[model samples]
Target: MLLAVEGLTHRYGDKTALDQFTMHLNRREIVGLLGPNGSGKSTLLRVLSTLVKPQTGRVEICGFDAGKLPEAVRSRIGVVFQTPTLDPLLTVEENLLIFGSFFGISGRALHERVRHLMQQFGILDRRTDFAKTLSGGLRRRAEIARALLHEPQLLIFDEPTSGLDPAARDDFWKAIEELREKRSTAILISTHLFDEAERCDSLILLHRGLRVAEGTPAELKATIGGQIVELVAKKPEAALETLRAKFGAAIELSDGILRVEAKDAHQMIPSLVEALPGEVLSVGLHQPTLADVFRKVTA
Candidate 1:
């Protein structure tokens, strides 16, 4: 395993941040760490990258123990933190040079590395531009490039595209895809967005401090089975509990919207109209999405 974590546990005083987490990543695999707030996804990344100490369990990245061999582990893994770390006063190239120095890289070699990374990210034109002047997407690309200066086999990104616009997000993924093609880099990505998870080779969905489910996007979606029935109701909140208790595991509530995985939503419509305060606004029968499976698993 390129990255292996087993029975990992972490705590802050009496509160548990991670509870018995177990997962792994192979070379060239992109694993998405997905969860709601405070679900331990970030905590897992912190431990794997050697930024935080775990109360229990082991993290072996590229055969080096993260806790026991801190220097060796840090040398092999690259991290792009969720918070902004780039200096606003420094230009993109300058930032890369400064970070590359940490890896004992400098002179022509470091410049060449920065050039290659900026070209890969399509930011060579902005190499001299200060990070503060770059768009959200460009800054993210720079940050990722900075992380890659040492040519680490594994790359960790936390909420990489959280505030990016649509075009920039697409551009970021394009860069990552190119990175995957060129280096076959094992990427560990943490994100709250389901669409972001879809881009990964596999996903681990979490709630609170536990891993609720983990698999390929297709495998996770397959957990729900059959078609999803979206019930457009007039009184969604009021009707949700009744439908769920009646429909059991098939029913789901999101905002005023309701979803049920059933073979025959059309057949069930008449009954809903008669009992519900409003007529059926609409009913959609479609294949279950990753979100649907996540809902069922996390509910």
Candidate 2:
């Protein structure tokens, strides 16, 4: 394992931030940390990155203990925080070069790496522009470029697309996938976005500072009764009780949306329509998605 953690725990006075959290990461894969806000996803990342001390636990990377050899672990890792923090006074290339030099890359090697990252992220055109002048998306890209300058073996990101528009978020995710293809970097990230979590090879989901579930997106989704049937109707509230009473443990409605979890959606649709008492707007049948997994486990 490139990264390993066991029995991790942290607390903010009386509230526990992590409860016996244990996880591992392969040498070259992106693993997402998923949960709602305050689920301790970010807290887990901080422990892995050695930003905050865990009251108890052992963290190791490449056989080096994280608590005792934090410097060594940090040197081999690149972290992109959720918030953007590019130096306004420095040009994009200059900012990247500065961070690269921190890891001891300099001279000709430094320039080459900076150029490659700029081009790779589609920001070569603005290489000479100061970071403060760039838009939110471009600045976030520049932040990513800076983190990759040293070619760290493990890369960690925290909500890389939290506040971006749809187009920018798509572009950011593309950049991350491209990096994975190029370097096969071992990545760990904390994100609330369901789409982001679904893209990961595996996931650890936290709910209120505890590990509620852990698995690949598909695996987790499969545990939610196999199938998801979405029933759309003109009178969702009026029909909910009938569906619930009939289906019992198999159905629920929390937000004007009803989910019917059964072995076969096609077989259940006829019974569902009969129970509903309005013009059916539509019906969708599919296997459970990552969102469904989160909702079922967390709700």
Candidate 3:
């Protein structure tokens, strides 16, 4: 196991940030922490990164107990935080060198590592460019490369693609996938984005400081066990009432939209339209997705 967390819990005075969370990760596996805001995703990452010690339970990284051997854990793990960390005034190469120097790497070894990482991440051409001059995607790539300079076995990222455009996000994930394949690194990513969560090998879904569900993306979606029928109604409340009378608990009202989950939902559409009788402005049906799984588990 590259990372092992057991019965982890943390609290902030009256608020419980984490509650009996347990998970294990293996080498070269990508596991995503999927949750909404205030769901303890950040708190979990903080504890794993050793920035915040867990109030109870154990966190072992690369065979080192985080509480007993924080330095060892830190050395074995690399973290890329949600916010930017590079110095805008420094060149990309300068930023990486400075970060590596903190790990006591220097001279020829440091230079070679930097060159390899930059080349691997496709940022060597931008090595001389100031951090402020790089685009959001390039800066993110540089930061990931910097994190790997110390050759940590585990890489932890917290919403690493935040604020990036779709194309940039795609490029970032491509690099991450390549890194895992080539280095056999274990990765833990915390994200609220559905697309990003879907790319993980498995996911731990959290809600209000508790683990709500855990499984591969396909497994979780399969738990929903049906199709989703969504409609925007002309009179949402009335439509909801009408639908509820027919579909019972299978139908729910969210954001002024009526959603129904049923086996073979496509066959139900005609009945739904007839039941609502022009109240629905538009309707759509699709297979269950990660978003649907989240809604089901959280609801």
TM agreement with the true structure for every prediction? 0.90, 0.89, 0.93
Candidate 1 lDDT over residue span 72-174, tens digit each: 9888788998888899999999999999998899899998989988887678999899999988778888887788888788889998876677766787787
> Each candidate: RMSD to true structure?
2.2, 2.5, 1.8
Clashing pairs in 1: none
TM-score of 3: 0.93
- Global CA lDDT computed for model 2: 0.82
Question: What does the lDDT read for residue 90 in candidate 1?
Answer: 98
What is the per-residue lDDT of model 2 for residues 1-299, given as tens digits with 9 covering 90 to 100?
78888998889999988888888998768798877778887778787787876679888876788888889988988888887778899999889988888899999999999998888667899999998999888887788778888877888899776666776667667767776788777888888788878788999888887888988888888787668888877877767867778878677775777778877777989888887746568888987788888887678
Q: lDDT (CA) for every model shown?
A: 0.82, 0.82, 0.89
- Error of model 1, residue 19, in angstroms: 1.0
Worst 10 residues of 3 by lDDT: 163-172
Task: Tell me, by lDDT, which candidate is best.
Answer: 3
Residue pairs whose backbone atoms clash in candidate 3: none
lDDT of 1 at 286: 78
Off by over 4 Å in 1: 241-249, 277-279
Q: How well does candidate 3 score on lDDT at residue 127?
A: 92
